[model samples]
Target: MRHRYGFTDEACAFFDFFAAPAPELADRTLTALQHALDTATLDHPRALRYGRLLQAYELMFWEGLREG
Candidate 1:
């Protein structure tokens, strides 16, 4: 089986926006879900979030699926 980090670079950046440097301590669940969905920068919010949910298994899932 394969595994990937629970958080992505963008997720870390999202956590940093609030924690400053404690992404590890950041809540990856719904607590940060909204912000993530908001900052996904994707043309399609639904699709971007869907990908983020699986980014670890496949970085391409949400790597550039979002818009700026």
Candidate 2:
């Protein structure tokens, strides 16, 4: 079956994160996102730009996942 929108491997990897009964992927995602936000703030001089980008990606991920 073809979906109107589709997910890539990297996104599936991230979305499958909350499936476990533990916190490994979630923890890693949190840490990575936090670092990205901080780095973007210091390097890009844009407040919350990286965070917003990540949020946009997450939103798009959910949209694609649910499109099937």
Candidate 3:
């Protein structure tokens, strides 16, 4: 079976921005994203949202690399 998921324009932009980097930079990107997530405070709603978005993109980037 196949599944479909919908993403907002903001989410699509996030994915596209990260997806442009070379495959070799995936690890670096993940590391940077992790650092940002770790440093982001829960009190700031926008920061938390972006941190989660970065995490999602990190997973997607890694999976894309594995498949390609």
Candidate 4:
């Protein structure tokens, strides 16, 4: 996907995570999501809501990869 500011090579490659040619891209995205979940906290107001959203994204990614 092109943008006015343009994407970094890594960012462009990330979009191809579902491609079979490089499954590692998907793995890396999953790992990053896992890390975000691990370090997430509820120390601030409305943090719970954001945390839930992040958790949901992680679950979706995990299931997507698993099903593929």
Query: Which candidate number has the best lDDT?
Result: 3
Q: TM-score per candidate, in order?
A: 0.20, 0.38, 0.35, 0.35
Instruction: Please give the distance, in angstroms, between residue 18's alpha carbon in candidate 1 and its true position after superposition.
Output: 34
Model 3 spans > 4 angstroms off: 1-43
**Per-residue alpha-carbon lDDT of candidate 1 for residues 20-44, written as tens digits (9 for 90 to 100):** 4445645665556667568974456
lDDT of 3 by residue, 1-68 (tens): 01235666665675566657667688996786688679873345776788799989989877996797
| Local accuracy by lDDT, each model | 0.56, 0.66, 0.70, 0.68
Off by over 4 Å in 1: 1-43, 56-68
Alpha-carbon error at 36 in model 4, in Å?
A: 18
Q: 57, model 4: CA deviation in Å?
A: 0.3
Candidate order by decreasing TM-score: 2, 3, 4, 1
1-68 per-residue lDDT for model 2 (tens digits): 11434866675675466545464768986787699777774444454687688779977877896795
Give lDDT tens digits, candidate 4, residues 1-68.
44755777687676566444564768996786677678883244465687689879977986996697
Off by more than 4 A, model 4: 1-45
* Candidate 2 accuracy as TM-score: 0.38
Candidate 3 least-lDDT 10 residues: 1-10
* Global lDDT of model 1: 0.56
